[model samples]
Target: MKKLLFLLSLFFVTSLYAQVEKVEPTFWWVGMKNPNLQLLVYGKDISKNQVSINYPGVKITKVNKVANPNYLFIDLSIDSLVAKAGKFNITFLQNNKKFATYQYELKAREQASANREGFNSGDVIYEIMPDRFVNGDTKNDFVKGYPDGTDRLNPDARHGGDIQGIINNLDYISSMGYTALWLTPVVENNASSTSYHGYATTDYYKVDPRHGSNELYKKLAEECKKRNIKLIIDYIVNHSGKDWWIYKDLPSNDWINNYPDMKICNFRGTTVFDPHKAEIDAKGMSDGWFAESMPDLNQRNPFLATYLIQNSIWWIEYAGLSGVRSDTHQYPDKQFVSEWAKQILAEYPHFNMVGEVWLNYPSMTSYWQKDAPNLDKYNSNLPTIMDFPLHNAIPTAFAEGDGWGDTGMNRLYDIFSQDFLMANPMNIMIFGDNHDTSRFYTLIKEDFKVYKLAMAFLLTTRGIPQMYAGTEALMTGVKGSGDGVMRKDFPGGWAEDKVSIFTRQGLTNDQIEALDYMKRIQNWRKSNEAVKYGTMTQFAPQNGVYVYFRIKGDKKVMVILNNNNDKQELQTIRFAECLGNHHSGTDIISGNALNWTNKIEVPTKSAMIIDLN
Candidate 1:
């Protein structure tokens, strides 16, 4: 009898251990605006058990069991009665017998967490792809568990840039006058190969060990705070890497869209807003997988939706991030995307979130912004969007010579004229080029004149400006060749590189000129109120010259883009409405005084930024 009892006890313990395998969000915080918290519990036959929490001011509002016996979505109401910082026990009962017990923690939020300011028009964002930026920690280059390892020679392979690399080079970024650093997703992309871009996330909660630890990411945020630089994390909601733990053992069949047979996405962004679209096409666009290796998540599932929403909030609270850039924002279920944005903004009212809506038309992109006048009553609640239309127009604008109407410099003016469609035009993120596009330097055929013009226009424009890594050094690459070429490692990031643009060593005169010009404009933009919060007035392009002014309060900034092959004298009288009483202005680039009384002479294919005093 004694032996029988002992054996039974051992069996019970073993069964209990296997019953509760994982609890997502491992922990949460108290004092959140939303009292309701949902915890996703995964284990063998976990849903068969009843969950109860005995903590004060916390009540088990609901225990949701889906078709999958391995998962349980436990909802709790954590009111003000709970202690600011403490651990509570969650007991699982099956047939009135204790099945398992787990300890959950509630942490005190950092001061001013909810009020953290996000990146705005006043900020210039420098976007970096970690794996291609710099390799600061050699020790983490080849993490043992992850399938892919570092291979600097292979353009598509991971180059092993880590969080430390970014931390080490914060000074360089700050020196360039960037107020924010937006790195591509740092989440673990434990795929077999081609995982460096970080879009395919295998682990949503943990940072890639090869990049660094979660603590290191938090440290990076802290360091950035000390330098007055915001950190914007790239987040993907549409899909997860095939190797994701949840994908291997899904909580339910509906956890992923089209679970058994992954259907490739149509990549048609218009279906989301297509009033006359077919159901099949819409489903193909939303429910289809991003790639064979990336499984599209079914945000329609309530449990999964809550999980993703909580995950985003958890990261924001955990990492102290200023904002998030949602990757492939339009591919997800439109309603869920709206709810996700709403919840995030509710939690952090001042936090900013920019969605990557890579549509070529202003109408399509504007449809996703919050409060857009869509034909359908859908509001994404997204505060910001990438100005892809403007980005696409810039290269063509610089490439074309003086023309009759809406050509050359006029193309730029035409693009901005569509700003009325945007809910908040200044909130849009404008860029010359990004990691996914052909480098700006290469797009204009390496013409230094056009490059400077593009840069000046990007900085002085009416939206938040973002620049790709190595843009200041005139990095050149064509996306048609492959993304790796465009995302090449930054010089001086590696110790043995022959050229270190970081120190102005081994650089050509043109490269030096480009770097210095960018530095001058960006640094000056950092403190200029006119560029940050000014109202813009543009004149019709004439003789390949485009002129505009940014006026705020007593400050005024006039910009002239001369796209002609020869220097032209721009008639200043045409811009008198913006120039007001200003007769003279100081050129930010050349430090030369400009007499704007009648006309100003601008060099060919160059931009002149004048501070009207």
Candidate 2:
């Protein structure tokens, strides 16, 4: 009887022990890989009071704790480990008990963006603020401490669009013929209400939960590469969100710029180049917070600079992105920004990056472009810059008759004349409207004719063209335009929406025509290598008409835009000389044969593209 009772007790004890299972963390991430393989592992587990890591061959170099209590951080050194594209075994233990083992695969550094050798001069970038683009995943839309998104109907509030949303609509973007896509910052934006824009970054290393997980972001980049679509991530180095991790309890007092007592910048970019300017404005440009909610970063501080540089490199390596577009380019320390670009370009020789200068003057804009002969000698390694000077010219040109500043043709003539100021005029990003202003459609009063004219100029113009997300369908909204209006749910993105552009349902005849027109132009631009890397030459403006030729070797594309109210005739002789003796070709738009030898007639407020094949 005693032996039987003892056996039952032993059976019960074994069963209880089996029921208590150990759980391992779900998501794990590492960054800033050195040859020594220093890594910071971040993960979460339900009941991990203590954690330890184990790996064969590779050394367990260091371990640390992260802010979250559920997370256990581990570091490893792969110095002695040989690299081949294969998996290695790693284990995690808690309190002397085995919890989980992972098969960590190692490979040579992954390719971010495409091989950039021939990439710089040819690609047209389409910049989309991801949160405002689409809401593919509704499950993780609202996160705690961030905005509370109970209503998808409100644009001023969080709208649940995420990285998964962009991934879901890869086909839509690809079909539009855009070779590259640039998304606004996707890092963790924990601020509430207005965080949807993603400019106020609370965490640099983590993707915002409201947007999607880091893994999902990586997947988006991978999927884009498969479609031959390049990804350029927009980064904000000027300031961080008010409630940033470092702001709450900084690793050090100087971890942030002007820590404790926030500072306001003078917003004087000219001072950086001014011969006799006050030191106050120069300091303010580099150290002043963009807004009270955003804290400026001190790039002059070596530690802060190192942290930022490493963070950027980590993302490029991790996601394999094609390029980077720096936000508020002139706001940071000019010297530091130069070094930042230098370090990144050194690591990625073929990589291309463009900074947002937002300067409407040609001289101010040209100062940032690489190799520009600026009197200040600001040798910024950055290769490309946003061409606001050209952007400013387009609207005034298309708006009414050619008066004082209203001459539509004069805008282009005046702006292009200053092209000598640019280091590489072909590399400038030319666009009509962006997130900060009213939509192009709203700006032009929803006129398709005017819109198409703008499109023609952008597509055939001398710079890398970037069309804002809704520019195709004429998406419009005023800034502070209430977030909902700025990023209206895509026509057919949501199941509840009445129209879906994807299926061509619920679109009017004109809307459908406009859509088709965009599709045609984008597709045409994709294969025209001459337009991508061609040299442009222009003839002096004549009677409100402007003509230019994009030529590469034997291939030539002549663009003639007539902004006048009445049809104008070109004497053919003048443009003939600019075309290098070619007198006849086919009109790309109408498919009509062109008689460029004797004379050329262009309709009022219309443009013609001729493929001189």
Candidate 3:
């Protein structure tokens, strides 16, 4: 009889262990704007059991079950006004018999979390691909269970950069006058190869161990906060890695867009706003997978939509993020994107979100911004959209000399003229090049003169400017060489690195000059109110020079770009409306006193930022 009892006990224990496997968002916080919480419970036939919560001030509003018996989405309503931080018991019952119990906790939020400020026009964002930026903790470089390991020699292989590396260099970033740091996604990307980019997310809630733990990521944010630097997470909502848990054991066939067939995306972003676009084309663009390895998420499914929305909010509240850079923003369902932005903004009113809308035209890009006057009457509710139109114009403008309408500075002038279509042009995130494109230095053909000109325009322009990690250090790489070439490791990020730009050691004179020039302009921009939140007045390109003024209440900044191969005299009389009574000013770059009454001599392929005193 004792042996029989022992066998029965063993069977019961095995059944209990098999009941539940995972509970996402392991814990939540009280006092959230939205009291409705959805807890995704994953286990073997866990959906077959009825769930209930007996905790004080917490009620199980509903239990949703999908076609797959392995999943259960439990909705809970926490009384935000009176909910206290404590552990609560969630019981799972099968056939009126207790099978498994989950002890969930609700924590108190940080002070002023809902009112946390996001990165804005007053800030300059320094974009870094963590894997290529630095490797602070070599111990976590090659994690077990992950197929691909670090191989710095191969441009396409992981180079072992981690969150600790970023934390270690917070001082370096802050000293450079950058107010915000935007890292490419650090989420778990357990792909067989090319996982260093961090765009293909395998786990929504966990940071890849190779990058660092989720705790380390939070610590990175805290460290950034101490240095007055905001962290902008590059979030991907359109797709997930093929190895994603949900992809392996989908809750339903509709969990992913294309499912077994895996239709590659059309990548025609313009179809989103094409009024007369065919229904088939629109569906193909939105429903198509980004790649074979990245499965497209079916945001049209309410469960998946809610899951993604909650996951984003969870990260913001958990990590204390300043902002979010939505990857492939237009590829997701239009309505879902609108709702996602609206909900996030509703919770954190001061937060900012910039979407990656890769359209080459200003009008189409403008249509994605919040409150845009779209003829189709769709509101994206997204505060910012990337300035791809300006991005396309920059290289062309610098490459060409003066022309009537389309060449030289006219290219930029024509682009900015359509800023009227945008609800708020200043909110656009402007960058010369990013990880996917050729480096800015290479785009300008490694010409330091043109590089300086591009920097001046980017920093002084009427938008939030972002600079890639090594751009200030004169890093050059062509996109044709592949993305890994563009996102090469930062020199001196590793101890083995012979040359470190982080310090002045082992740098060419041109590199040092570029670094110092960038620092000076960036620091100057930090304190200048006119450049930060001023109204812009740009004059047409004349004699190969593009002149613009950023004027606020009592402050004014005049920027001149001479793109010619020869010196040009900029007439001061034409800028009388902006120059006003100011007879003299100091050039921020050369520290020369300018006589506004006479023509200003601008050198070939040079830029001048004048403080109108």
lDDT of 2 by residue, 401-446 (tens): 5656536677787898888888889888888888776778877778
Better of 1 and 3 by TM-score: 3
lDDT of 1 by residue, 243-322 (tens): 89889988778989987987999998899998899999999999999899889999998888998999999999998999
Candidate 1 root-mean-square deviation in Å = 2.7
* Residue ranges of candidate 1 with Cα displaced over 4 Å: 1-18
Model 2 alpha-carbon drift over 4 Å, by segment: 1-107, 111-119, 144-147, 403-406, 480-485
lDDT scores of the candidates, listed in order: 0.90, 0.74, 0.91
TM-score of 2: 0.84
**For residues 203-313, could you state the per-residue lDDT of candidate 3 as single tens digits?**
999999998998999999999999889999999889999999889999999989887888999987888989889988999999999998889998999999999999999
Worst 10 residues of 3 by lDDT: 12-21
Model 2 error, position 86 (Å): 9.4
Better of 2 and 3 by lDDT: 3
Ordered by lDDT, highest first, the candidates read: 3, 1, 2
Instruction: State the local distance difference test value for candidate 1.
Output: 0.90
